[model samples]
Target: MDQTTLLLFIAATFVVAGFVKGVIGLGLPTIAVGILGVVMAPAQAAALLVIPNLVTNSWQLSGPKLKAIALRLWPMLAGTCLGTWAGAGLLEKAKDGSATLWLGVALVLYALVGLKAAKLRVPAAHEAWLGPVVGVLTGVSTAATGVFVLPAVPYLQALGFEKEELVQALGLSFIVSTVALAFGLIGAGALDWTIAGASLLALLPALAGMGVGQAIRQRISAATFKLCFFAGLLALGCYLVLRAMG
Candidate 1:
């Protein structure tokens, strides 16, 4: 495909993905990776996703509940940095390993669990160790698999947090993962200026979709929102598996 057509298609996907994440607090990678995987390497997909992730989560961070979430989730953020570093390192160094399959499986499982979890709420308190564990998985996934945002969501949901709290947590987690993944991708020499430009261009759609998402938030039932989110995850997983098989 030509550059303009590819960019338009990618932009449309970004809008939908942002809308979904705006409404649902997840699906940034599920949407970006699933579609972009067909057209680019996983590294490119990740690079394309970085700015949008930053922008979307930055909006989410302004919520009134954001401070509380920051206080509660700092451990996880710290842990994510370490976990991501380790995970990214292993993927980078392990010559025989295929991180793509791991990413696919995680995406499918996350969708399944998250879909079921939409009925519940985010927890007020979660395990201290959970952050580092999920963070590592998330980081490694991004470095090797391109979907590092997965490990944080289901567990956070099971913790029974408020809706806004949940959104902020997911948003924050993705932003953190994006940072780690950017570093990993950079260290691996996979970052690109053209793709970074594309990601920046996506900021408008990201914000626009977030506006739609916020508007839809009141109307969205947790079950329906989760169902759509998980469905996207499943579809993305299948696509990843197929790509690996190919």
Candidate 2:
């Protein structure tokens, strides 16, 4: 794609991704990375997501129980950082479209889990050991595919946090994931000034889209939107997988 077209594509993709995030409390990086993966390497797409993901997720961190959530989730957060560091350069080094293939697989699995509406419950006793395990898996996936939703989201949901607290927990986890992924990308020499600037510029439209989504959130059926979101993700994931294989 030419420069102008690429720029337009990036902008439009972020708008839609941001809107999804606003309504659902997550998916900016997943949607942006998956769509951008069609035209660019996963590492490059991940670089473009750093700023937007960080800023948007940071916005979601405002809540009364922030400290409590942080305290409760520290093990997982630390594990994510360590796992991401260990997995650094995987995407950059992937050969034969492997990164794209894995990205597609990640999306497909995530979509299926969401579509299934699994109501897993994590007993408090097991959280101490299980959280870090899930975090490590999530971090490794993020390092390879530029997506971090897998077991992390599911695990967080299983914790049975109330609605607002769950949102805050997701925000905190995403913030850590974004920062960890950014560092990983930087270590791999994938992120630089140009990508950072473009990512920063993408933030405006993202925020705008978020505003529109938030405005409509009260009026729309979240369950219906979620159904469509997962369905789209499933289709997109299959397409990416086939494209990679072909």
Candidate 3:
């Protein structure tokens, strides 16, 4: 892509990604990577996501709930950091179309469960053991695919969090995942100043789109937004799967 085209693409991609995140409280990385991956290399795409992901999620993390949520999530957060470090090695060694395939599979599974509106409950007793396990999986997936929702989102859902709490938890989880992924990318030499600068620039458009999405959220039902979200995920998943196969 030329300079003009690349600028346009970045503007458009973040607008869409941020809108989704504004509405659903997550999906920035998934949407950004899914769209940008079509036109660029995976490592570069992942690198571009680092700054925006961290910045947005940090905003989402600020609230009275922050401390409570952090206490609740410390174990998972720790596991995620470790897993991302390990998974970075996997990313470095990835061959064929494994990264795309993994991303495709993760999207499809996430969409299916979301579309079904499945309500899974984890007994409190299970959370200590399960949360870390899920975090590790989410970290590995994020490192390899630049998509961080997988087991993390589902596990959060299973906790039966109130809607607001769920949103906060998602923010916290994503913040940790983004930081971990950035470190992983830096270690792998996938993140550099140029991509980081571009990523920082993308933040404005993303924040602007979030403003628009937040307005729309007031007018539309959450159920409607969720339906659209899952539908989009399904289509994106199919595209990724086919692209990998082709």
Per-model C-alpha lDDT, please? 0.71, 0.92, 0.84
The TM-score measured for candidate 3 stands at 0.95
Residue 100, candidate 3: Cα error in Å is: 1.2
Best by TM-score: 2
Rank order (by TM-score, best first): 2, 3, 1
Q: What TM-score would each prediction reach against the true structure?
A: 0.83, 0.98, 0.95
lDDT of 1 by residue, 197-226 (tens): 877987787678777887998886966777
RMSD of 2: 0.9
Which is superior by lDDT, 1 or 3? 3
Candidate 2 similarity to native, TM-score? 0.98
RMSD list, candidates in order: 3.2, 0.9, 1.4
| Model 3, position 76: C-alpha lDDT score | 88
Model 2 regions lying over 4 Å from their true place: none
Backbone clashes counted, model 1:
6
